[model samples]
Target: MRVLHLSDTHLGVDRWFRGAPTEWSRADDHLAAMRRALAPAFAGEVDVVLHTGDVFDRSRPHPRVIAAALELFTEVARIVPLLLMPGNHDRHGLSWHFSALPAGLTVVDKPCALQLAGLRLAAVPFLRDPAVWAAAAAASCAEGVDLLLAHQCFDGSTVPGFVFRPGEQPDTLGVQHLPRGGPVVLNGHIHTPQELRLGDTRVIHVGSTERTSFIERAEPKGALVWHADGGHVHRVDTAPRPMVIVRGPGDLRTVEPEALVALGREARTLEMEAEVASRGGWVASWPKPSPQMPLFG
Candidate 1:
C-alpha cells in the first residue's frame, strides 16, 4: 500500500510583511502547492492521502478559504481517499465548520482506529487538555496498527530559530508516551520535515506545504510518500514560493530601491532591514520600498 502523507497546509493564512505579496497571492500559492503535492494521487500513484492536521489557518476559517478548501478537496477526493485530522489551530470546533465534507474525505475528530486495505490506521486529533489528549492517544493505539497519525509536538524535535512565546505550552509528547513497537508514527505541528527513531518505532514529521514565515524559508516544503511493501519513504518537493531577507547599512533614504525590487521579483516575500548611524549608536529600521522608487546611496 502506498500513502501520501501531508500536513500543515494552514489555509486562509494572510501573512503581511514588507515587500511581501498580497494575501490573496499567498493563499493562491498554498492552494497551488497542495495541488502539486496531490499530483501523485491524481495519477493513481498513491492509494490514500493522509493529511495529518492544520487544514485551516484559524479555528473558524474565512468563507473564501472554506470555499477554496471544498473545491480542492472535492477534486482530490475523486482521485483518492483522504484522511484528515485537525491540529491545534483548527481543532476547537472543526467538526461543526466542516460538517459537509466531500464523499471520499474522512475527518478524524476523535481518537479512533480505522482499517483500510489490510492496514490499521490509528488517528489522534489535537486536544487542548494535555491529560485528556494523553488518554485519547493511548486509547487510539490498537493492536495490529500499521500507522499512527497525530497532531502534536514530540519531545526532542526542534525547528531551528523557533522560540516559544510566553504563556504557550510546548505540548511536548515523548516517544515513550506513545504506543510502542508497532506502527510507524507520522506527526504534524512542526513545520520542518524530519525522521527519528525511538525504541523500535520510526517517527516521521510531515512538514507544512506552504512557507508560513521567514523562519521556514530555508526548510524544504513538501510531503512524504510511503511504500508499505518496501517500508521506504521519500520526500517529494511541492515547490513552495521562496522568501528572501536582505540587510544593508544606511537609512531608508539611502537604500537602493532597485535592489529591493529585484529581490522581491525573485521571491514571494522580501524582508529588508537597514542600519542607520544615529546620534548615540546604530539603529535598525525596516522600510517598505516601492519597486518604482529612485535608487540612492
Candidate 2:
C-alpha cells in the first residue's frame, strides 16, 4: 500500500508581520503552494492519505480557507481515502465546528485502531486530557501492524519552537511507549519534515506543506510519500516561496531603505535579526503608534 503523508498545513496563516506584503496575498501564496504540493496525491498515486494534524493555523479558520479545504479535500477524496487526525492547533472536542468536514475523510476524533490495507492504524486525536490519551493509545494498539498517529510534544522538545503546542501530549507518556510491533508511525505537528527509526518501526514526521512562521524560515518544507509494501520514502517539496533568515546583529537603523527593499524582493518571504542601539528605538518600531514615529501612521 502506498500513502502520502502531509501535516501542519496551517492554512490562512500570515506570518509576515514586518509589513512588507498584504495579509491576503501572503495567505493566498501559502494556499497555492499547498495545492501544488498535493497535486500528486490528487493525481491518484496513493492508496491512503495520512494528515496527522493542524489543518488550520487556528481553531477558527477563515471562511475562505474553510471553503478551500472543503473543496480540496473533496477532490483528493475522489482519488484515495484520507485519514485525518486533529492536532494541537485543531478543534479536538466533538462539536458542531467540524460538521462540514469532507466525505471520504475519516476523522479520528478519539483514539482508535482500524485495519487499513493489512495495517492497523492507531490514531489519537488532539485530546483535552493527556492521561486519557495515553491510556487510549496503549489500549487500542495491541494487535496488527501499528501505524500510530498523533500530534504532541517530544520529551525534550519545546513548544512552538521545538514542538507544537497550545495543546500537546507529552511524548514520554504517549509515543515513547507505543508497542514496536513493526509498524510505520506517521506524525504531524512539527513544521519540518523528518524521518526516524524506532527499533524495527519507522517514524516519519511530514512537516508543514508551507512555512507557517518566521522562526521556521530555515527549515526545508515538504511532504512525505511512502511506499508501504517496499518501505521506501520520498520527499516532495511544496514550499512555494523562498524563506530568508538572518541571525546576529548589524544595525537596521543603519540599513538603507533601498537595501531593505532589495532584500524583500529577492525572496517571497524574509526574516531578519539585528541589534538596536536603544530600547526606545526598538519599542518605537513595534505595533504601537507614537507622535515621534515615522515608520507607522
Candidate 3:
C-alpha cells in the first residue's frame, strides 16, 4: 500500500516581517504546495494521504483559512482517503470540533488503530503532558507492518539553532519509550525533516510544506511517499516570497533610501540590523527581527 506523508501544513499562519502581515500570501503558498504534494494521489498513484498533524496554524483557525482547508481537502478526499491528527498548535478539543468531518476524511484525535490497504496504522495525536503521551504510547502498540503516526517531538531530532525563552522548551518523546520491533514511525511537530533509527524501528519526520521562518531558509521543505518495502521522498519547492537581510551602521541617515527601495522590490520580506561602534572602536552588532516577525502558529 502506498501512502503520501505530509505534516506541519500550518494553514492560516499569518507571519509578519518588518511589520507587514503576509498571512494571506503565505496561506496561498501552502495551498499551492498541497496541490503539488497531492498530484500523485489525483492520478491514482497513492492509496491514502496521511497528514501527521498541525492542520491549522492556531487552535481556532480563521474563517478564511477554514474555508481554504475545506475546499482543498474536499477535492483530495474525492481522490483518496485522507487521515489527519491534531498537532500541539491545534490540539485543544480538536476532535470535538472536527468530529463531523466530510466523507473520506478521517480525524484520528485519540489513540486508535486503522486498517488501510493491508497496513495497520496506529494513530496518536499530540499529548501535551508526558504522562498522557506515555499512556497513549502504551495503548497504541500493535503488529504487522505497523505504522505509528504521531504529532510530537522525538528526542535526538535535529533542528535549526534558535534561542528559546524561559519555560518555552518544547515537550519531547523519548525514542526508548516508543514501541520497538520494526514499526515505521512518522512524526511531526519539528519543522525540519529527519530520518533516524530507534533500535529496530525506522523514524521519519516529514517536515513542513512551506518555510515558516527565516531560520528555516536553509532547511529542505517537502513530503514523503512510503510503502511496505519503503518508498521515495523529495523536497517540494513552494517558492515562498523572498526574504532579504541588510546590515548597516547605527545611523539610518547613512543608508541610501534608493538602495532600501531596490531591496524591498526584490523581496517582500526585509530585515535591518544596526551596528554601533563600541568603546574599543569596533562595531558591535546583532541581528533583529524584520519589522515584521513570523509569530509561532
Candidate 4:
C-alpha cells in the first residue's frame, strides 16, 4: 500500500515575499503546492493519502481556503481513501467541513482505528497534555494497526536553530509513550521535513507541503510517498516559492531579491511582547523568575 503523507498545508496563509521576481499571494502558493503534490495520487500512483494535521492555518479558515480544501479532498478522495488527522492549529475540529466530506475521506478527529484499502490505520488528534496523549496513543495501538497517524512533536524534531529533545519541555513526545515496531508512525506539527526515532518506533515527520514561515525559508517543501510493503519513503518536491528573510545590519536597498539579499541594517525590533508574536515574528519575554531555560541546557 503506497501512501502520500503530507501536512501543515496552512492554507489561507497570505505572505508578502520581500524579494521576488514576480508578486504572488502565498495563499495561492500553499494551495498550488497541495494540488501539485497530490497529482501523482490522482494519477493512480498511491493507494491512500494521509494528512497528519494543520489542514488550515487557523481554527476558523476563511471561505477561499475552505473551498480549495473541498475541491482538493473531494477530488482526491474519489481516487483513494484520505485519512486526515487534525493538528493543534485546528483547535476545535472543522465539523462543518469534515461533516460534509464524502465517504472516502475519513477525518481522524478522535482516537479511532479503521481499515482502508487493506491497510489498518490508527489515529489520534492533537492533545495538549502529554500524559493524556500517551494514554490515547496506547489505546489506539492496543490493537495492531499497519499505519499510525498523529499530530505531535516527537523528541529531536527541529525548526530553524532549535531542536525538540528530551528535556523539561513537557510537550515533547517520549519514546516509551509510543508503540514500537509493527506500525509506521507519521506525524505533523513540526514544519521541518525529517525522520525521527522514538525508541524502536519509526516516526516520519510528514512536514509541511509549503514553507509556512520565514524561519522556514531554508527548508525544502514537499510530500512523502511511502511504500508500506517495502517500508521505503520517497520525497516528491512541490516546487515551493522562494522566501527571503531580510536580516543583519546592512544596506537593504542594494540586496538582490533573486539570489541572496544582504542585510547590513537590521529591521527595527518591536518593544511590545504580543505584537511581534502575533505577527509570527520572534520575541523574547522573560518570566518573573527563570533561573531556568529548557531551550538550552
Candidate of highest TM-score: 4
What is the TM-score of candidate 3?
0.75
| List of clashing residue pairs for candidate 4 | 249-264, 249-265, 250-263, 250-264, 250-265
TM values, all candidates: 0.79, 0.73, 0.75, 0.81
Candidate 3: clashing pairs of residues? 16-292, 16-293, 17-292, 18-290, 18-291, 18-292, 19-291, 19-292
Instruction: Report the alpha-carbon TM-score of model 4 versus the true structure.
Output: 0.81
lDDT of 2 by residue, 1-297 (tens): 777888878776643333332223455656776776676688777778887888777787766667777777778877777776778777743223455666676767667888654556888776546566667767777765447887754333333455432245433333445454646778776666666554565667777887665456557777778886677888888754544332223334443321211122222222442322121111112333333312111
User: Positional deviation of 51 in candidate 4, in angstroms?
Assistant: 0.5
Predicted structure 1: lDDT: 0.70
* All candidates in order of TM-score, best leading: 4, 1, 3, 2
Stretches of candidate 1 exceeding 4 Å from the true structure: 17-24, 128-131, 162-170, 249-297
Write out the backbone clash pairs for model 2. none
lDDT of 4 by residue, 55-135 (tens): 888788777678878888989999899877788988887555654778688776788888888888888888877788878
lDDT of each: 0.70, 0.60, 0.65, 0.73
How far does residue 64 in candidate 3 sit from its true spot (Å)?
A: 1.8
**Global Cα lDDT for candidate 2:** 0.60
State candidate 2's TM-score. Answer: 0.73
Show the lowest summed lDDT stretch of 10 residues, model 3: 276-285
How big is the positional error of residue 203 in model 2, measured in Å on the Cα after superposition?
1.8
Q: Please write out the lDDT profile of model 3 over residues 45-83, one tens digit for every residue.
A: 888889888888789876667777887887889888988
